[model samples]
Target: MVNSTQVSYFTLTAYFDTGRLKHLYFLVVLTLYILIISSNVLLIVVISVNRSLHEPMYMFLCSLFVNELYGSSGLFPFLLIQILSDVHTVSAPLCFLQVFCLHSYGGVEFFTLAIMSYDRYLAICYPLHYNIRMTSNKIAVLTAVLWVYPFLSNVFLVFVLTVPLQLCGNLINKVYCDNYYIVKLACSDTTVNNICGLVKMFTVILGLIVLIIYTYIRILKVCFSGSKQTRQKVFSTCTPHLASLLNFSFGAFFEIVQSRFNLSRLPNMLRIFLSLYWLTCQPLVNPVLYGLKMSKIRNACKDLLFGRKIYL
Candidate 1:
């Protein structure tokens, strides 16, 4: 149990006590990470080189690939190191930085998805104007916001880390450093931190939900007014975006629930697995979902794998 009154820094270590299970876990996670890196990098390269795919949708897909790459990089490398070394202990400052990186990337990714949805709405609803509206300047501005907003949010979050937290037990139940979990161990009052976190969560997740839903509704309205062929084409184009959106939504929802709810009644192993569902499983699934569902991405990947020249 972690208490808030201890003086010395506590080191929390995570390990798979089950020998075979440990090996399996490492193998599985390593394999998934490799797939994630390869697929997303392939997507990025394909988009850059394939002139036919240099449109708004593929451009947004490229952005998503970039986000996933950074997000996974922020997460898995440290996890891989810890798993291999059989050590889970992290210093207080290090833990704080980890939390900052996780949240920052997450917030940015959420915002980028929202932007992508709006892009789709424009393309489907006002095809004549989409190219104009989603011009290089506009995309640049949105991309800049995606990069800046998260950094600012993390800067604000760092204030919460300054509060003296007594670390009695250093063991973090989850695979990675979570902000709420770390905050719970702080000896100082964390009302402000909690409030800030809630604000950040609502600002990113709730805001994106509203924006995405609005865009989809508008898209449906436009599709309904179009010819059958047009409607089918629109639906086909939106399918990949919808799949990506659902994956992100489900992953984020459970993560928020797990962090808020006290699962003290459950066994530690179960709790850890539940947490890993979001942190590990969800991220690993994103690139796969995109690659499998998006025909454009699929073709791009084929060209990449087969050593065909990618024309931009």
Candidate 2:
């Protein structure tokens, strides 16, 4: 029964209504965010300083780390503010920017993962040509394309779909600003927006997943065909990246599916928890998994932390 004009004036507000759980959630998330920042920053520094990590795989990893940092920064600071102040109000422009950054980073992340898979494929399946194929210039071009393409996609989405919407219910069901939540709040029919979102999600998730799988299959074939020592070495090298891909894939899937389903009936606290898990936890898991499961990164980190220089 609310008029469009009234909806324009209205704003969504979120707060921690739970008694002790809110504090506990905030503490846990804050701690995790700190760790994410520290670990990713450390990784970037180490990779930059360590000459041995200048190869394509590590370069891609560094790029992923940078994107993860940006992704977390885009989502977590606003979330923490909302949690602490018990105010989740966001202006329309700010909300759009939030969605833009989120999607931009997400799209870039998808491409980065795909590029990483290709890097592994080259390294494993075409070892002799790997250096030539994944040279510094080629890597730079790939990285630039990964970032630019996503930015353009988000820009197109905003202009073509979101700009025309009329605001009805200003409340975004989820904690952070998301494309679907914003579209759902539109007073006007959002068929086009929803369709665009679906198309982009499908193309990015399904298409990229197919590519990653194909690349990995080829990698496996090459690995198993090689000597046992080579096979083991390849497996060890790829295990950490595989873990990262799994973490990212699950998180992306969860976000896309959750956005499609109308889960407004769920409690706000639960929604907050889910959002935190999807956005913050996924990125945090990457650094932890890489540091613990990858011997090179772990030893490098140890040396850096202990003020010892590790050669290679």
lDDT per residue (tens digit) for residues 1-312 in model 2: 343334433244545465667777678778878998998999989888878777788888898889989988998787777666555577667777788888888888889989889888888888898888888899999999888899998998975678567776777666777777767677778778778768976887678889899999998887888899999988888888887778777776667666677667887666656655657766788778777877877888888889897655
Candidate 2 RMSD to the correct structure: 2.8
Residue runs of model 2 more than 4 Å from their true location after superposition: 1-16, 198-205, 262-271, 310-312
lDDT of each: 0.75, 0.78
> How many backbone collisions does model 2 have?
0
Error of 2 at 32 (Å): 1.3
Candidate 1 lDDT by residue in tens digits, 162-264 = 3355454555667788767767666556777777768866877678789999999999988898899989888788887787777777777777777789877
Prediction 1 global C-alpha lDDT: 0.75
- The superposed Cα distance between candidate 2 and the true structure at residue 16, in angstroms, equals 4.3
In candidate 1, stretches whose alpha carbon ends up further than 4 angstroms from where it belongs are 1-10, 13-16, 159-171, 202-204, 267-269
Alpha-carbon deviation at 53 in model 1, angstroms: 1.7
